[model samples]
Target chain A: MKQKVYLYRAFERFWHWSQALIIFFLALSGFEIHGSFSFLGYQSAVKYHNMAAYALVILIIFAIFWHLATGEWKQYVPTAKNIKAQINYYLLGIFKNAPHPTRKTVLSKLNPLQRLVYLGFKILIIPTMVLSGLLYMFYRYPQNGSIEGLNIESIKTIALFHTAGAFILVAFVIVHLYLITTGTTITSNLKAMVTGYEELEDTTKSQLESKNEVISAEVNNE
Target chain B: MKKIVISLVLIGLIIISIISFVSPKETKQSKLNELKAELSKKTTPSVDHSKFPILQKKIGSPQEVTEACISCHNGRAQEVMQSNHWNWEREEFIKGRGVVYLGKKNAINNFCIGVEGNELSCAKCHIGLGMTSSSTYSYTDSKNIDCLVCHDNTETYAKAPEKGGAPDQTLDFSFIAQHVGKPKRSNCGVCHFLGGGGNNVKHGDLETALFEPSKETDIHMASSGMNLGCTECHKTEKHLISGKMYSLSSMNRNRATCEECHTDNPHSETVLNQHTYKVACQTCHIPVYAKVNATKLDWDWSTAGKLKDGQPYEEDDKDGNHTYLSIKGNFKWGKNLKPDYIWFNGTASHYLLGDKVNDTTKALVINPLNGSYNDRNSKIIPVKIHRAKQPFDPVNRILIQPKLYAEKPGEGALWKDFNWQRASEVGMKEVNLPFSGKVSFIRTEMYWPINHMVSSKEKTVQCNECHSRDNSRLAGLKDFYMPARDFSPVIETAGTGIIFFAFAGVLIHGVIRIISTRKRKMKV
Candidate 1:
């Protein structure tokens, strides 16, 4: 059993859960706007999307401020410790109940591989969407003389970027949703997010002892 | 992280502001208006603008003077005002205020003395306002201008010029309608150039052959009085002025030129195949005199006192029985790549008032005319005997690309093999139009409806896997089927499947640990 302290603050939990909700709705409405579904028809989907975008921006601002004030931003600082080990365990070892190579602590809520994944989402996907969406929304009514440097007669490039970014964002959401279900207890991690508390072992010392004995007996039988 | 986010936001606002303020289009519209106002002020005269007296009854056409003669000579007062003929008519001034040549008639007025005087010649023509003959020309102030030239021909001042006279050196057909057909008649070449001989009429379609667009164009010099422009009626003929007579149609009045009234272009609006908008008429019609007569146009305006049209200054030359132009050329549209501006040349004379005479105050409409020129670059030269008699410009431009629409896809749908064709007509007999053809991609390829942009929220078109790709664990487009391209499958069988099973194992481990933790907490 591994032990872990109360690392995630109330604000952190709030930011995480709220961000997830916003992104989920954003993906839904965005696809709706892209003519993917009819849950909210084209017009309503666009309305909801625009509203969700505004709300996401507001939530991000608060989260940023909270992260800055609390110095809790260090949790997502990506490092390469046990990175290969983590990959291998996910690829093969986990089927035999192989233990995680990295442990969680109050100072570091995410493991080495988790840090890399979080960094990619923050650096690549989100910023791409923000820039592309803003360009698309306000690029209108351009007269020939107004922007001499720009070819206002054509908007193919901007549209292409906006559409491409949308596909990437959707792709990321699909993967994220799948991985969420793969958490510690199909419903347990989900419950923890809802209740803001996760029960766990105090240390991996007992877990390692039991596993070692089981391993030795299996080897002998083989 | 907090500082980084804030900075990014502020940077975006700054960038947007810079883009908004740097546009240049606002300056051009104002400049065009200013140029128009300046040109109008400089070129159009303010004198002789008097109120015309209204008469009660309409006068009947003279039985002796034919309708052909009536149209050719009608509005001579107005036409002369627009030509160089007015220059010769001006009363010579020895000094400042007093008018000389007051009672003296110039020998250039040949039309009144010629043999065709009553037979389609200027001598037999009705002199409208300023001349001395027409013994019954009861009007006074002989130099002012007469409306009776065409309106009241019986006044007697009109007549055709005689043989061996200076080319009736009088202004004729100075202004013409645009649509007049081929063998151009009076519309295009008459005032466009001063060709042909003294008493011999020039250009084929006589002045009476002109008609409006709404009317059918008469082909031969003898008109059927159809609605067609001078270009349509005259075609290639350089002379002839006797034919059927029709009342002139009123101008559209929305604008004086084709451009102002035709901002929405017909050629591009229909876009039958594919093409960009056509250029405005004036853009390529800039004035060049060589383009008028001789060719291989050259210029030395860089030097002073340079003679334009260097091939023997033809005017007032002793040996000039008129050199036969070796190169015969036809009139056609000139090609112009630049689609924006038109530079034109013209002059306005201050003197030559028609007739300061009897009840001539009927007001003429002051139409703001835009100078028109056919682009000659696209037209092939017509084979003809004389230099000026050949066709000079072409009317239609068909060398442009067509359009392809995504949604409506009337003609555009044909390219992508879209079958929006009328489904009911497949079994019908005698369907002249085939709803399908190679343009519809009927054969050669079977990938129909491949590039359709039906990204609309139709469940029939939307793929669930496409929308949900990002929601799960696929890093990129790791495994998905696209209908547009050839695809063998995303995940190969055997080894890859084994790896997927391993991923499933990790998920199961996580789930069991989470379950065990919850149970232990419950016991405690």
Candidate 2:
């Protein structure tokens, strides 16, 4: 039996979709600026890329506040438990019709592998991109009065870092899209992200009941 | 679900509003336009010189008129005497080559070689009245200054060709002297526009079209635009002009810059404003030079003296510009030309007359505008490069200063006798420089910075002209990194490879998963 459960919240779904759209736009415009291709023309590409960057920054600030306020940041705290099992399931078990080694619940939403990847995205890739991009935007040629303590002589290094980060982000989006299909059903993850609801196995109900009993015992003791 | 939809719509609306609010808008009014508008208001001169009593008498000569003018304006003649226009030279301290007096008197150009033996004919443009030869003319005589040449309001004042800088015999000196007020565009254009023996032959930006120019010819000098005179931007004080061409000047001082009128940060866009640090205003403003007239691009003196049936002849192109002359040589002219870009730091070094030719294998740079991307003062500027193949001394390793002009045919002038050996000997003897008795043609180049014929803002160089991958305006400048035009091959290749592989990997993975699932379903 399958039971429908509320998974992603409204704000979380909004942030996810907004970030996806922004990243895609940034990639398109950034690559155009890199002279890889011409789409919106060079000037327009630069203008739009700069605008989208600012939008991404604002979105990131709001997402950070939201994560901290709701304690959703803990969902991405990587753990060793069931990590190997999750890896094995992806590598071999999924092809042989084996059952998942981990179960999803309201409190712990991500599999261990997903936790590690999301944590990496938050701590490493996102910060690197943001810092390098800000430097690229604000860096003045030394002849034009320079920023204090940031005597950057050239934009070559900053541009390279930003371009490399863009490539990494594009690659991540590709893999993330493919992984979205590996859920309960081919479209289950996408549907949950969109509608904030997913159908899980009935075993989650027993787990919820046990948690409720523990909460009642604690209340009686108090 | 309705709440989610409402929230999403609200977020989208907020983002759209933010973008619309922060995006840059087209500025309707700019400070430069306001300044131009203010300047366009015409002002009549406070005193009309047509009623002056000192100019009523019949003037004997152009020099006599100068003497009469000095009787009232006492110190002005002394000021003119000290100017570069009067002495034809100035004291300049060149780098590596100590303090030297440099000017047209001793300077050599690819066109017409030098002014040593050709002073009589060349004096048609000289400010002074009597310059029979370099050795005999008295520069100290205050009477020699031609006051009406610059101060003449009557456009009829003209110096006859090869008349030792004397006014045309037919001109009424008394009428011109009475009408003298201030120099008009025609006075400067008379000599400057006709430099190098023809209209618009030397400096590509300066031409006869500038006298009553339309807006497309020049914004500043346009009759219908700002309508500025030569003295407006040149800013003369005590007869010493503030601007000096890098070809003639070796020092960085006394240069008129765009910053003098329009501040350095003149752009509405921050990115463009920042570009002022490395790019000159002329680089973008003067997109194409020689706008209305074609300027001489190449002169090959090696082909001179090639006559049909021993009679000197000339050939003109469809535009009436000279293509070949039996006396001068073959010529190439360019119209509406895009200028070459270079890094200039206001300082330049000239290959002066008698300066030994060090490299014969390459085209000699007559005047090198010194700068590099690493220099703090350097900025990229547009320049018109005039190339020529002129006579040189291969044995002495020096450029030959051949006599080009003479009053009569038998005077050893190359134009008269068509004999390079006698002309080179006489020219070298006049300048007190040794000649090898052997003349060879040498390829040489001269750089003339384009500072006029400024286009309107709408027609200025676009961003893609320099920032694009193909046919960039700055394609020749490779010292520094420019975005879109420059990138590391290693990083670009690696990044592209990673993205390509990731795309292929995902496609293959999706296909295999589909096939495997189908097989499992069939077995079940």
lDDT of 2 by residue, B138-227 (tens): 888999898988988878888888877888867888888888776788888888899899999999999999988999889888888778
lDDT, residue B106, candidate 2: 73
lDDT, candidate 1, B1-524, per-residue tens:
54565555446545644544454335544554564454335223332212211121222322222223334446543454432222222243322324444211221111111111111222122233223222223333223332323222122222234311112223231111111112323323233223223111122222222322111222111233222333332222222221211111112121123233223232221211011122222221211111112211111111111233643122221322222221111121211111122211121111111211122132211111122222211111111111111110011111001111122324332112222222112211111222221111000000000111111112221222222324311122222221111122332233235445545754576676566657767778
Worst 10 residues of 2 chain B by lDDT: B21-30
Q: What DockQ do you compute for every candidate structure?
A: 0.08, 0.43
TM-score of chain A of 1: 0.78
Error of 1 at B258 (Å): 18
State candidate 1's DockQ.
Answer: 0.08
